[model samples]
Target: MAVRVDLNLSLDGIAMPANQTAENPMGEDWGRLVAAYVGTKTMRERVLRDTTGEGTTGVDDRYAAAYFDGVGAEIMGAAMFGLHSFPDDPDWRGWWGEEPPFGYPVLVLTHQQRRTIDFANGTRFEFLSVSPQEALDQALRLAGGADVRIGGGVGTVRDFLTAGLVDRLHVAVSPIVLGQGTSLWDDLRSFDLGYAVTSELSEAGVNHVTFAR
Candidate 1:
């Protein structure tokens, strides 16, 4: 049987704003958004910080922690992995500190292969310059019966969901709006994607909703 799992968190209409910086007009208020969504949880660990600088007020921190708590392996996009084109600078680590939040093995989807990056914190980033199916296979192998998580930049998540790979999804809809930026629902064709509400909470300005597919 397929591994039962949960992928949690939300974005503005499923799209990453054009510029993710805090100063970017398109950037969402990270602190309020994070708190409103992922609230206090025992296993909560803050993995990705809003490069927008609302780290202390992170709304997604709780969810990221809870989600990571449930997964054994992670698959992320090249951009989200911090190797957009190429990391020519060895001094340039990802958006995270020396030890990234994803302490487990993280498989990054890329077109150009690169060497593995091993941090002292037991976190390792392996470049998977292969198709999504190949990457998923590798992730499952690394999972060793544990659940696999498809980390996102929207496109990656949509791809897996459309292929019926995602078992569940959690989204925290923040109240703020971005007049223009990348939209989460951009080219997704409609299909019978059904989700049952698992839970709901309100904080800051947004509503946090959990859906089981």
Candidate 2:
């Protein structure tokens, strides 16, 4: 099983946009960063649960479809799970709705202890207070030989990338420049030396870049 990561970055390589608040947990420029991905048919139907038959069905949609292709389990950071936004609230489920798109086990890396939450759609949120490798071990077991995804908000992805645990890295480079934010390539100098890389530009101006080992 492979460990994969899919992220949206700006032209400046800002994966996590700045100006974050409780009202907008994803940050102010988040929409612009992921505009192309969210506009795809697969994202509309899958994540948004929109069945209107709308949304683009081009190259961006294909990548969006592949985002959920073989992911058996997910490991994400606290921010990705909305813990940083709603830490005090005991009832805060997550940014995802009642039936999250993930129909598999998901591990949230957070220090704040919480009980495991199971959804009816086979999606289980198990909070973990462990290292990146430890979390990956648990996710691998839960994956049952299927591919494990390193879903991120920034820090989590960097941890896995720094540890050289990721097998596939795909980033949708949106044509926007956010002056301030955490970049995906921060401290990752010469990170592409070992991987075979390819790039394709979508109709929506998103450059889909993939680094595969």
Candidate 3:
């Protein structure tokens, strides 16, 4: 079982854009940054629940489909779960609506809430305030020997990356340049030194960069 991370980033290495508010939890350029990935046929059927034979069926679709390939459990930050936007709203069940695309256990790391939310489609949100290793421990057990994914909002993924716990990292770098935001490649010079790095340019115009151990 591998510890994996898949994120959409900008060509400038910006994983998240600034100017985030309650109205725009994912930041101003979030949609544009992930436009190519979300436009894939896999995302259309899974996240958007649209299976009308629409959406792009190119190299991006292959990566989109592989995102959920063998992920048994997920670990994410509260921001990725939408808690930063609807912090006071107890009814806010994340941005994934009634049924999230992840059909496994999800560990949400936050210091505020400690509620365990369960969905009918096998997705369970267990809020935990613990270190990355602790969260990974629990998620590994919950994962039942399958691969565990560190789903992110940049900071969370960076934590795991800094700790050297990520077995594989795949970044779908978009073609835009957002000058200000949370940069993903902060403070880690020559991060690719120890890993085998590879790149692929998709027909949708995004570059897929992967660092595998």
Q: Candidates' lDDT values, in order? A: 0.61, 0.93, 0.92
Q: Candidate 2: minimum summed lDDT over ten consecutive residues — where?
A: 18-27
Model 3, 1-213: lDDT tens per residue? Answer: 899999999988999899888788778899999999889889999999997979999989999999999999999999899887778888778888889999899999999866788899999999989999999999999998999999997999999999999999999998899999999999979999979999999997899999999
Candidate 2 lDDT, 62-173, residue by residue in tens: 9999999998999999988988877898877888888989999999999999999888999999998999999999999999999999999789999999999999999999
RMSD to true structure for each model, in Å = 5.1, 0.8, 1.0
Which residue pairs of candidate 2 clash?
Answer: none
lDDT at position 44, candidate 2: 96
Per-model TM against the reference: 0.73, 0.98, 0.97
Q: Kindly state the number of residue pairs that clash in model 3.
A: 0
Count of residue pairs whose backbone atoms collide, per candidate = 8, 0, 0
lDDT of 1 by residue, 1-213 (tens): 132333323445634554565354325633443444445432233543434344323445555455656577888887776665335654445667886876778888877567788899777888777777788888888877777778776677777776667666666676665555555455655533476665444445455566565
Better of 1 and 3 by lDDT: 3
1 versus 2: better TM-score goes to: 2
What is the Cα-based TM-score of model 2?
Answer: 0.98
CA shift at 77, candidate 3, in angstroms? Answer: 0.7
